[model samples]
Target: MPNTESLNVAVVGTGYVGLGTAVMLAYLGHHVTGIDIDERKIEMLRRGELPIYEPGLADLLHASESRLTWTSDYAAAIPEADVIIVCVGTPPLPNGHPNLRYIAEAARSVAQNLNGKFQVIVNKSTVPVGTGDWVTRILEDNAPDYHANRYAVVSNPEFLREGTALHDSLYPDRIVLGSASQEGIERLRQLYRRLLEQDFTPPEGVPRPAGLARPQFVTTSLNSAEMIKYAANAFLALKISFANEIAGLCERVDADIEEVVHGIGHDQRIGHRFLVAGAGWGGSCFAKDTAALISTGAEYDYDMPILQAAVDVNRHQRQLVVSKLQRHLHRLQGKRVAVLGLAFKPNTDDLRDAPAHDCITRLMELGAQVVVHDPVAMEQARREWSHLSYQEASSAYDAVRGADAVILMTEWQEYHDLDWEQAVASMRRRLVIDTRNVLRQLPSDTVLEQIGRRRVQETHALPMLPVGASSVHV
Candidate 1:
């Protein structure tokens, strides 16, 4: 935590997790070189342009001064660094297993470029339990001359939320460092000592959460650390599935899920975090991790029924939105449907496993003309989902304008700031289905429908519908 000699660090891959860590390490006084195979991404970072949408990352990149640099030359960046962190993506395969091609290639590159000096190789991506050993094996195969004493492989899975990654990294809730080599653990710990103890002052845009407790430094076994990442995400995904299941029941019985969640969430044992009833849980972490966990369980001859059910429920959750629309408009063969918020979540431009994209697809299947909008993720949405025929809107209001029915998927703050009076005035049917439960209430001229509740606990005004107007409580 002192202003001692800086260590040389090389981070491979400049995606969300990789870039966030690189910027934070550079600001912590380490000389960091971010290496990637993508020349376009490298050029963007070299020109002080952000390739992804993460808050405070650009500021940290500019504030890092001479500590951080991005390049595509692995030979120049990898061999000389004291520590190399592999942050490449481990995308899920077709059968739910993780395709670790990137991890294998990264190990091959690092081994081929070894400098014959003691160095720490940390795995920051969310991979399987035995991936640490697999990476070490790849190193052994590629760099046969180097002995075990020359390098150490460690599992240091990331727990960053996309929106607040900068703040989360600078002041983490906990730091998990797992390795078989004590020397490797100590070196990584020294690199993270400042963050572990909250030593440095955070940058301008990065705000530490209120009442932030002392960050816990969890030093344990290599495989234990890998399991921690999967377990944490699988549990969060389970909570979301449970909340949606309760919402389904709440709709049929006319009991509000908002009050139910409040009553249960207030208990000390069960806190209110991912307990919101919504279309479904979607993002880079939950679905991918849950599926991989189930696949890994199967490898051990264990059947994870709960986790499997969670996956099934998530698939059904997206379809629930389409069912609501179908119930309202019986013959959905050409309806102007507006979908607000396209990204998996607010504050991220990532559309990986986003529920809104699935909803748009299903609407199109039913012959509905869908229009989409997101404050910052609209461009990414169009690029990712070009196969789907959905017109992109400049703003949330523009999406809702002349829409037969509007569905809210992502809970961006911009979507919450809509002028409901004018927005609903332009709707053709004046029916609003709040999937994320974002809006407090609908306009008096419209009929309101949300995911969980039915006008019992929440103050969402449920006025009598106009004659012949269709409304769905779910």
Candidate 2:
């Protein structure tokens, strides 16, 4: 089991990925200090107010406030920290490669503050393959007097979804630690021995597998660990884009893509996790990490045509949503459009490369008066896209009320469970676009047209398209 003795750890970055990691580690009996550059965000965290919207995160942060601390001062936190995990963002550059400025700054920040003994510096951010080496080089360059043997750089990329980050962190399928040094690997493994033990209690209400073997901890070289993260996300994104591409074909020949997905998903080898056809995959990880992998491929003189196709398909999926809307009204000008969700996906307020951004922006350019609503992401939407007209509604019904057309952008459960009867009665026209196909129930008056599928305009019935079909008539 992990040593119950106090572990002084500092987690850099307080964004969704960082805060979740810090809070989970703190809950696992570690004294964790969270560091971020934003003063306002630091204040919010200090007051036990989580800036992001992940379920079970705020409760854990509030519960562990004494054991967990927040600070904007990286130098202050680093000295007392035994393990410093870098969780900084690696946003995509204009050239479609990862901009490692934040990662570089974070490494420099850690180097400047290192004065004492051995510390395990773990990179939990999704970065390029060689980042661990680069981070090590930076530390070596800056900390000339610091003992080389006193510190180690490790790669442990996070695989948490923004919405289910806490759950994923607390009960991961596997915890991967990548470092060339055996000592570094052992340090990380010892730190997480609690998770690897048999007698250790699992979190409350989380059912342990009766006969199934407990999750394994995989340790390897830093390069393998980094590649694992990129490979996993890229493959999932590829699956999503592939399903979406199939949905487009299904629309043409009137084949049921849902049934096709069901048939394919049941194939044990092709499990049904990310096979749902939608507008496209978004959020921070998929795009940035995929681009990073492609960049790495370019750097190594290798070809990743599959990843390139996945990126291309995702971009095209957004355009397909816009094209579907254009078909309905012929012109978006002077139309009152209501968007149901603004965040990339449900349960998080991250709007990075969200499909809604493209849909809303295109609608606005066409003169559509767009009214937007999300369960918790409206505030972020308001801040990012101030030029667009956004209305904060109490519910999805309010957003759609009196609108000419409504688009289901983010697949929030509230939108899934919306009172369709009331919504249709309140709307001027019975027009609705299910971009994510979150709605299954049909309203009496509303015309529900799913993206990558044909329009269904009948009472008490919905049309299902066939898979791998031809033609764009839908």
Candidate 3:
């Protein structure tokens, strides 16, 4: 087990990634200090308010308030930390490469603030393969003195999903660390000893480790570790887009994607995850990381044709959803549309490259009045898309009230059990677009058409169209 009695961890960048790591480490009995540039954000943290939406995160923060400290003081955080984890965002550039300015800046600060003993600087952010070497060089360049052995750099990329980030962090499927030096590897092993040891079970009744010898600690080289994150995300992104592409094929052949996904997911070769056929993958990780991987391929004079196609398909999938909406209604013009969810996927309030953004923007461009309802994404959506005219509704039915059509964009749990009768009654026209393929059952065809209602099933749908498609009644 980790000697958690007196370990100080400084987490730079207090966004979702940073906050998640800091709070989790604190929960694991480490003295964690979160450093960010935003004073207002720091104040919010001080008040126990988390800016982002991640289930079990706020409660984790509250539970570990005594062990976790929030601050904007870079100097103080760095000097006091024995292990500095860089959990900052590495946003994609216009040319589809990761912008490493934040990573470099954080590394420089950590290097400049070096004080007592040797520290392990863990790169918990998804970065390019050579980033470990780059961070090492950057830190060495900015060191207080030329003490080469003062600090060690290790790449320990995070693999937390936005919605269940807390759970993923605390009980990760695998913890990968890449380091050149023995000391750096040992330090990370010590920091993650609890998880490595697998002392705690995965919550109550949450399925124990399957066919595994407890939880083995996997350590690898820095390049492999960095490559692992990109490769993993890229493959998952490919799977999502691949499933979506298959979903389109299924729709064309009148095959139910749900049944197909269920069948395919049962195959041991294709484990069930990221296979939901809907508006393609989104949020901070998949897009940026895939693009970064492609960029890396470009730099090496190699091509990632399959990954490139996956990215293309994901982008095109958003447009496909918009066309499906337009088809459900004859035209989006003069239509009052309700978008039920905004976040990329459910259980989180992250709207980065969300399909809802594309769907809403396209609908508005075609002259539709859009009202949106999400259990937790309203505030973030308001901030991110202030210019879009949308009435925030308390419930899904409220959002669908007086709407020509309602589009289920993100598949939130509340949208799962929608009151079909109320929804049909509230809508001026009963045209529904089920993009996520989440509709379980509907009223009989006669009852639905009698109510002038039609449900647009997202199956074998064509790509990039100008509306006008066949719809199923009920």
Which candidate leads the pack in TM-score?
Answer: 1
What TM-score would each prediction reach against the true structure?
0.95, 0.92, 0.90
In candidate 3, stretches whose alpha carbon ends up further than 4 angstroms from where it belongs are 1-5, 200-213, 445-474
Please state the error at residue 124 of candidate 1 in Å. 0.6
* Predicted candidate 2 versus true structure: per-residue lDDT over 1-474, tens digit per residue: 244655798999988888888887787788899999999999998888988888777777766677888889977899878889999988889777888899999999999898668889999998888889999999988763777677899999887888877667765688898998787888787667665663455555333456645557988888899899999999999999899989989998987678788889999999898998988999898998888888878887999999999999999988887787777667878878888898999988989889999988888788988888889987887788787665677778778777777888898888888767667666666677888876766654457788555555544532222221221111
When 2 and 3 are scored with TM-score, the better candidate is 2
Report lDDT per candidate. Answer: 0.86, 0.81, 0.79
Off-target runs (Cα >4 Å) in candidate 2 are 1-5, 198-213, 452-456, 459-474
lDDT, candidate 3, at 337? 84
Give me the displacement of residue 427 in model 3, in angstroms: 1.1
Q: For residues 1-474, could you state the per-residue lDDT of candidate 3 as single tens digits?
A: 134354899999998889988987787778999999999999999999988888778777887799888889888789878899998888999988998999998898888898858899999898888899999998878878746677888888788888878767766778888988789888877778776666654443233456545345668989999999999999999999988888777766756677777888999999788877777888888889899988888998999999999999898888886676655565778878888899988999999988899888888888988889999988898889997877788888788777777788887878878767556555666566777766656533211110011323233332322232222435
Query: Lowest lDDT 10-mer window, candidate 1?
Result: 456-465
Off by over 4 Å in 1: 455-474
Assess the local accuracy of residue 464 in candidate 1 as a C-alpha lDDT between 0 and 100: 31
Clashing residue pairs in candidate 2, if any? 2-194, 254-466, 255-465, 255-466, 255-467, 256-465, 256-466
User: What lDDT does candidate 3 reach at residue 420?
Assistant: 73
Q: Per-residue lDDT for 400-419 in model 1, tens only?
A: 87788889888988778887
Minimal lDDT window, size 10, model 3: 445-454
Model 2: per-residue Cα lDDT at residue 247: 93
Model 3 gets an lDDT of 0.79
State which candidate, 1 or 2, has the greater lDDT: 1
